[model samples]
Target: MLKWILRRTTGKCELERICSSYPAGAERTRAVEYSLSKSKLAALKILLVSDGLNASDAANNIITLKGVDITRNEGFRPALLQCLRHISGYQKLVSEVTRLQKEKYSTAIDDHEQQLLKLWSLLKPARSRKTSKTKRVGELGFQGNDPATDFRGMGLLGLQNLVFFAENYNRSARKVLSESFHPKFGYSFAVVGINLTSLILELLCKEQLKSHFYNSVSGEPSLYHFHRVYCHVFCEFHDFWFAEEPESVMEFSRILELYKVHLLSRLTTPGMRLHSEFLAD
Candidate 1:
């Protein structure tokens, strides 16, 4: 077959050929993924699905199976290892995000309560304690007195994303929160954060975020990486919502769909990396 001919003539396996032919990021990663998925070896097939795989060991096994010579193909091992880490790291991030999404927010959970309180403190640092929970939460754009209910759909994942943004990007978070108070263009901050979480979850579930992740991260993606993506989404949505200048909050669903469409189009590019300009500030 042509594959055998290429292997014998070029002294490289299909994976090596793919790796050497394409640069890193979406093109290389996607090709490597395809090569591994179609591999006849059971180990290679398992690698496609397994998480927490040892990249070095996996790379060594791959080299042995493919009869790659280290001296001649010295770059193959490290290149393959990087691809393996990225492939498996994506799966691990999805699992972690899914777990967080499924975890319900509970009043009894100290950590949950603490995170909620932290959000309040970060966004309303100047507010007095005398304000009722309903009124106070409403100011931040929660649907009701209890912000807990707003998190029902996204679970703790939503709350965690908000907290991470507030904690890590305090200035930008506050600026966005302040912008949410614009009388004519205003919207609920917490509520929009939860909605963005749904958007992020949808993108991740559909694997639409692969290009962004592959281009941005060289190693295995983690929950922190996922959270960073959420921050970018939230920030971008904030800008998009204001730029469109919709009649009111009633136009949110339509505007959100437009943003999603634009986002998807951008993700289709070869090396799309989602980053918030606000992060630089």
Candidate 2:
């Protein structure tokens, strides 16, 4: 085969050639992903599907199989290890996100109730605490007297995303919540947050987030990284919603589609990383 001929003539395997040729981030990570997916060896192929794969052990397997000389090819090991970490980390993230998505929010669970209350406290610190069952939950932008019903679609993941944003980016979260109350451009803050959570979960499930994560995180992507991405998307959506200046909330579906189109275009760009200017402080 021409590949075998090139391997012998160049004295390096495809992965090594890829590492030496391409710089780190999306391009190199994607190339390594493609190479592993096409590899004839079972070990290499497993790397594409397996979760929690040890990067060092995976690097050793590749080195032994490809006969890479560590002494001469100093960069190959580190490069391959990073790629493996990103690959495995993405898979693990998908699993964890999916698990959260499936977990239904339960009032019987004390932790869920506490997390829900924490979201209110972070966003509405000026207000006095109310029992979890109070109709006041609507002030945060739920449709009815109870906020728990909104979680039926996105499950516990929705609550977690909202809480993470409010807890970690308190100022930005409260700012967006205030913007959502604008008389003309007013929208449901909590509802929009839940919708964005679903959008992000869809992107993650489809593996459309690889480029962003590859460029942003140097190592394994965790739930924290995933939450940060949600925060970025939420902030971006807030700006996008007001910029559109629709006639009313009825235009939400149409506007959301337009925003999603814009987001997908950016995600496909090489080395794209989503970060909010609001987070700069």
Candidate 3:
């Protein structure tokens, strides 16, 4: 709430960056590559001086602090080459591992259509929701919150089960429900609405998140992701949760609250707000 208001007040496109209320973990897959690059620059500087060549100004600036004559130090070349070689090998291994994991995930999802159907059936309708043959509301989104407790509570474990039966939610499932299942289950079907999608996508865009709120003794899933997927699935119902209390600008916090938003925290030109407004409709 605070972040949303700060973006609007400060006029930033951070609508995609600030709504994260969960933990997405360290996404630093490029850390090793960057470390390698820095190492290579330092090593090349040493090699240059060993052959009686001067370090480039840019390289010299870094070497000034390290106080190491990499070129003069013949012993380090083997270590540097070995490190470079190791980084290269690790990159290949990471790529292969990622590829295999993606394949396994695709296969698992591809094989579970009926299970998804069965679990989705668990979304019984509320009285106000329209009864159509679609999993969507014409305008309103999912309107129920006395969540269907027939399954395990709303957590990754719950979605894991759903995902277990989820055979490619990416395609025909949406199409088929967009076509047929809703007619049969529209009376029962509930789905997400735009506000929730925007919020979830916004959460995914955050550069950082404070996620201790998601910790549980069981280590089930991040609290933010849990609420996020819930919003994704049920935000389409009539009076869907987010719609029940639309976002409002906040300038102050209550006694028991600690909300903060920083629209200009890292801004180089505060006047960009006006420039952005000039170009935006």
Clashes by residue pair, model 1: 134-145
For 160-258, candidate 1 gives per-residue lDDT tens digits of 999999988988899999889998999999999999999999998788888888889999988898899989988899999999998999999999999
Mark the regions of model 1 whose C-alpha exceeds 4 Å error after superposition: 128-134
Lowest-sum lDDT 10-residue window in model 3: 272-281
Question: Per-prediction TM-score, please?
Answer: 0.95, 0.97, 0.24
Backbone clashes counted, model 2: 0
Candidate No. with top TM-score = 2
Considering TM-score, which of the candidate structures 1 and 3 is the better prediction for this target? 1
Weakest 10 consecutive residues of candidate 2 by summed lDDT: 272-281
What lDDT would each prediction earn against the true structure?
0.87, 0.90, 0.29
Candidate 3 structure lDDT: 0.29
Instruction: Put down candidate 3 lDDT per residue, 1-281, tens digits, no spaces.
Output: 76458656754322112212212211111222233244535653343223222224423443354454555543333333322332333333333323332332111243333333343443321223322223342222223332222121222233332332223232322332343233322322223222222233233224121121122111222333433343323323222222323232121122001211222231223122111111111
Q: What does candidate 3 score on TM?
A: 0.24
